[model samples]
Target chain A: MELRRFTQPSATKPTHTTVSNSEIAKWNILDRPLTRSREELYLSTFSFLFAEAVQYLQTRVQQVSELEEKLNQLGYRVGQRALELLCFREKLNRREIRLVSILGFIRVQLWKFLFKKSADYLKKVTDREDEYYIEEEEPLVNRYISVPKDFGQLNCAAFMAGIIRGALDSAGFTASVSAHYIHREEKSRLAFTVTIFMIRLDESVMNRERKLAG
Target chain B: MSSSRASTWNKLGDAAYAKSEKVSADLVALTYGSFVREIIKDFEEPDQVNKELEKLGYNIGIRLIEDFLAKSGISNCSSFEESAEIISRVAFKMFLGIRATVSNWNSEHNSCSIIFDENPLAEYVELPPEYTHSLFYSNLLCGVIRGALEMVQIIVECEFVKDQLRGDDTNEINIRFKEMLQEQVPWNDEE
Candidate 1:
């Protein structure tokens, strides 16, 4: 696994690749795992801590729409982390191309990586082009929240949505996650529908990747 | 990229449990407390004991995502079935040192019987009746499952059948899935 094996110029290391430009990676010859520069699992642990921080911020946010935008930002950061891991975790042979294909990867591979199960099922709106959803009841991230009247528009789980949005956006898919009003339908039902806008690549980007894969 | 990556679709029941350490609900709660303080500053801590516990579980949901990823060999747990089983065996076992076996599953949702084979966290624990059947820290577990599954668009419901946080009783959880009710549809969609 050459770390440099990425086929896309876009996949090249972003400026945020690591906390410090100076710290270099060390390979563990014995285990053969890519040993991170630091001894701590701080990156992963802190990533979670940051998620909590995002939720904390949403508590006081009065407007749901404003809160959602903020959450999308928060999730964007987390999503970047997810994207890095997802791309690296893949064998690096060929990249996910078609909308359904990338989604399939997300459902099973990415979903498994994050949750333990892929979304319970997959449904697409035939009327909507390039709009797909991993419809779920009872979003795990939002389970404990009882949103108050003051924060009429905000759902703290929007923080998670932000992470998802960020992850998808970085991977070049223009996506946004929204938490729908889940009450009345079923109090126990918590659904987060992710709407991914198809990234209709400029013909050049598509042609380039196809050439690279070939 | 082993030859196995060829088949992206895998039945979760068939996947082998990842060989990793399990996590405990107690540990998850303790960690989530910080999450609450950090995330929801204005939100006063719930007075009701069960709600407080559920709050902690919510924090755990923020975390278990990363934990679930690392311990399960990162990529081996790829398919939905594989992911579900890994969450059941390795993720739960690594954290809780117990396994929740699937009791019933349908086209979408399923239930699992979580027998507390041994509970160090519950070594001398006791819960009042009000909290006995409560989901406790496991609410985040259900939430995480829901979120993770939703990433793939499978709307499902998960609830505890029993509580290990409580004493002397067998425990399990049920997750149900049903048809998506169109908001404007006047008729009952589930029936």
Candidate 2:
């Protein structure tokens, strides 16, 4: 196709014709298929962009919770879309059959899609059957983020938590996901700090899971 | 420009440029392409997606310009030619790890083209046959350039004239200087 055929205006022309309805319909992006099945991005570029995003959010919001909330909101949209696309790609039964199964899907499938690897650990809380833990030694989202001393109790992983919440909620496994920093004194070779994502499913979801299992 | 000034600018560019750790080009390209896809999904309209991507690039550019200035220690360029050279050599090299050539200079020298031999952003990008008439795959680069220049008081109109993904031999961005902005100083009432 000729590059000029796209109807882009010349530098001399200040105004251009608006995209027509038929043109818009023909080029609807959502209707398009994935151009390539698997592709990767530079980790440095991702880190740089993520850092810029955090910096931008910091300038906009005042409180720690607000920052986290903004991050969560950003992640929420990603998670929702990821759930739909991933489910379609995997061809698994639309909704996960059981609670453990959903957690497993998130720990493995979702992690693989987002970070190219399964989460480090997936464990059920010792006393609370409803609470599950998805741990990552260095969450990809937080790999480049370094929370300052003044911003106490603020974890950028809150964005990842929001993603988990969005995915689970959309998949009919309603839950609350929160990220907690786990400081290790031994200091591994990797520079990133560890984080544990805690997911607490709603009572209704648990009941439904039990019912479905029964 | 004087020889001393030219040498000073070159020295600054050299000093400011650092070789950071390398990252997988595939990872960067895929993530950015996916983000563009996500934006398209949100808007559902190709034009809207393009506008949004530009707006997003502008926002990133406004802040990124500060980083560029600080890291490069470049206060200002003597002329549009100088600026174009720096952008193609220093700025692009430092950030994206790619060096673009400034070519196609107009007789008035108000406009030129930055040609990229390799685009990390379009490494794995493919334009589906149906959407060939639309979708500038690397539109974000145009926005970033425009936004960064705007922040530095160099108002320029930028566009992607050629995209390798669309079968162009090289990725080319055409930039035309609109006007040079004059700095305004606030007057004191007492004076």
For DockQ, the strongest prediction is 2
TM-score value, chain A, candidate 1: 0.58
lDDT of 2: 0.72
Please give the DockQ score of every candidate, comma-separated.
0.02, 0.10
Tens digits of per-residue lDDT, candidate 1, A1-214, equal: 5765655577564666443211111111223232221111222233344455555555656656766776556555555655565566454566666556766766676555554456654557577554555544544455445567766645565554555556556666665555444433436765444323222324454555566568
lDDT of 2 by residue, B23-141 (tens): 43434554465567656666777777777767676766776777787777777765677788778776776667666778899999899999876676755356788555577877877
Query: Candidate 2 lDDT, tens digit per residue, A29-135?
Result: 45434433424333455675566556656777899989888777667666776777676666766677688888898899887877778999999999997999999
Those runs of model 1 whose alpha carbons end farther than 4 Å from true positions after fitting are A1-55, A59-62, A90-92, A182-214, B1-191
RMSD versus native structure for model 1: 19.8
Tell me which residue pairs clash in candidate 2.
Answer: A40-B26, A40-B27, A41-B26, A41-B27, A41-B28, A42-B27, A42-B28
Q: What's the TM-score of each model vs. the native?
A: 0.38, 0.60
